[model samples]
Target: MTNLSAFLAQNAIKPDSQERVVSKRFVDPETKEPMKWQIVAVDSDRDEALRKQNTKRLPVPGKKNVFQPTTDYDAYLATLAVECTVFPNLHDVDLQNSYKVMGAEALLKKMLLPGEYAEYLKVVQNANGFDVGMDEAVEEAKN
Candidate 1:
């Protein structure tokens, strides 16, 4: 987590940017090794372009709206929680709960295994804030 903050700072990720989302740790299944988590913002333009390219289908309609990349913090966190693969009981519980709360918003997608997601959650829980990078973004935005 601390390392992730540093990496983000080194990369100049802006705190105020709507694209900013907290990254979580994930574990690789093949080797059972832990890996850094990543936060991803929704790429609406790219998605739209994809949809246009594949107009044969309507993109399951409203699915994108249910989980827009930036604002879906809970969904995003939930996504990570399901990816760590370290915890199964917790993952299943969270998935079931999220399914109910989201009313299929999260159900439509597959979640990471419990064991994998658990390990990842451990890394995320210790996640750090990117103070230096955030400061730079603030200054840059002001300029």
Candidate 2:
């Protein structure tokens, strides 16, 4: 996994364009809720504008902040790429490799298992090509 991690780590794109916009988000741990933060900077100076943009964009909702109990995370900020609105964070190859190694199906199952739909496990089993009577399990759950 070290190679995979290294590949991911290196593939991280460094921000290039100067003009950036930033927004803040604060999370409520008890409910895992997020509040959109106010936008901070728009300066005439390129350096100042870039600094503000970097500061504004970094924090992502589920990926970065997990809400630790000991300290106040209000100071913590993340600046995400504005282009991500149009595209995904990682390239196709990286995403595919990540899925292969991380087993995104299992992650989805773990997240969805608590809901009223108990077919998460069945779906995951089927996706993984397990012959564990998944069709019957899914059909039964649907009923």
Candidate 3:
């Protein structure tokens, strides 16, 4: 095949799907290492669903408890994440066990600390170019 033909054959992707990776890394407290995540891009339909899921109004006024129907903010973003990779000097097995233990919240706590869920939000958005709160009021405004 011609070089152009060969390159296209190797690099081309199916139009139906796109791939993206997190622009930043998360630090693992258990292993004291940094890890990165990757994921596939969701279409506009999926984005709309996420927007709806994250925009739930508070059931009662003056109550912001997370347990209630208050906005999830970025929970939808987390659902898009597919995998995470740790930085050098950390064994894969160790990280794997921690994945079994610390889970996403603990890992994010270690990675982002004072930023907490905000950092997790950043990781998910940066990975797939999602902005969680950008449309928090779109539905109500439309109605």
lDDT scores of the candidates, listed in order:
0.39, 0.32, 0.46
Q: Which pairs of residues clash in candidate 3, taking residues 3 or more apart in a chain or in different chains?
A: none
TM-score of each: 0.21, 0.16, 0.36
RMSD of each: 14.5, 22.5, 9.7
Q: For candidate 3, lDDT tens digit of each residue in 37-137?
A: 43345656877776576666545557565333444544544443322222221234465466554454344444444554455455545545545454653
Estimate, for each residue in 1-77, the C-alpha lDDT of model 2 and write its tens digit.
25565458568654332211111233456766553212222223642343344333335468766432221111111
Worst 10 residues of 2 by lDDT: 72-81
State residue 119's C-alpha deviation in candidate 1, in Å.
Answer: 15
lDDT winner, 1 or 3:
3
Poorly placed runs, candidate 2 (over 4 Å): 1-117, 134-143
lDDT of 3: 0.46
Arranged by lDDT with the best first, the candidates are: 3, 1, 2
Worst 10 residues of 1 by lDDT: 15-24
Clashes of 1: 15
* Residue 111, candidate 2: alpha-carbon lDDT: 26
Q: Residue 83 lDDT in model 1?
A: 36
